[model samples]
Target: MSIEYGEAQLLPGEKIAITTDTATEPFWKKAKERKLTACRCASCGHFRMPPTPYCPECQSREMSWPDLPGTATVFSFAICTRSPYSGEPLIYVPVVVDLDGAPGARLVSNLIGIKAEDVEIGMKVTVDWNPIQDDWLLPIFRPV
Candidate 1:
């Protein structure tokens, strides 16, 4: 699958709605507590992001969520001049980061606290919360 995005030039004003369900509620729930978590296969210990209903490695519906270190490496990123959701002119860095403690698990989040030109692969970062609609927090990253 191909995901297309761009390098964001400046930080955008965040005001979007988020919805969750059985497979992803735990993630949002933990974010409310200021914790980072990833889904793990209860039977195999394999970690996955965007929490799936079934494990690809073991096909087990059973899952466990383990708290992460709130640290990650930038696997890929983009600096864009437009908001992905609203299509208005804005600046934000969209990034795919490899979770520090969860092998093979990566999160798609925005990067802040650093300039767009300076962002690079293998950059170390830590999580920061973005308060959005419904009292939920979105996980964004910043240089560590």
Candidate 2:
């Protein structure tokens, strides 16, 4: 039998912090405004996450940011039973998701609003934001 995990991994008073740079800042900026975007190759129209400066497809620095559908498919996941920080008992699901409207781009984020046992590969989910440090937002997902 599997142990029960709570709906949230971050305890009541905890917050998440993040750091962003030039290449990745656009995505984070959009996220802070409650919008979801993926980096696209302006020339070849390919999508990539963790946004890089040049397109791997056509060797171009031109890129575009387009809002996504805010939905995703659970490509893979893992169930955690302990907090990496506190070493206390906690349960949260870490997932790699295939983003809608962004072909070939996958994002690593957390899954919330569902029990651990119910999370399945290929499950449909939608984006939900959690506040993080410096007034930023995090994109967690819920069942769609």
Candidate 3:
């Protein structure tokens, strides 16, 4: 993938730092096992699909991993064709998906298995998981 920036860039498969959150650690651990886990606020009874320690709605610390709807809609997207570094263009579409059963909750991921030009802002999409390493399984998205 190419970055729109003209200066130096980072490439895929290159080492990078991923900030982890205590609330989301369980989600990641479950992702390592190829399961999509989300968080739900026990107090408010609202689900946070991406997982978080405190509920953004009520600021309650009573959170737990609950089964997600495993469905989403594309709230926004961008057609990306430039890689961070110079090489064969790895075209990808970046999108923010609003999770079902959790209004206003969204997560960002690459839109794969479809042409970038065909992406739309309000398109229907779904979650996808790909294991890149022994311990890292990334969550991606695709058209439904």
- The candidate maximizing lDDT is 2
Model 1 lDDT tens row, 89-142 = 776788999998899999999898876777899999999988887888888898
Clashing pairs in 2: none
Regions of candidate 1 where Cα sits further than 4 Å from its true position = 1-14, 85-88
lDDT of each prediction vs. the true structure?
A: 0.86, 0.86, 0.68
Top model number, TM-score:
2
- On the 0 to 100 scale, the lDDT of residue 108 in model 1 is 94
What is the TM-score of candidate 1? 0.88
TM-score-superior candidate, 1 or 2: 2
Score every model by TM-score: 0.88, 0.92, 0.76
Q: On residues 30-131, what C-alpha lDDT tens digit does candidate 3 reach at each position? A: 767666656778898777756766788899999776656677888888765676456556576667888776665688777776666667788888777755
Pairs of residues clashing in candidate 3: 1-83, 2-82, 2-83, 3-82, 3-83, 3-84
Single out the weakest 10-residue window by summed lDDT for candidate 3.
2-11
Task: Assess candidate 3 and give its TM-score to the true structure.
Answer: 0.76
What order do you get sorting by TM-score, best first? 2, 1, 3
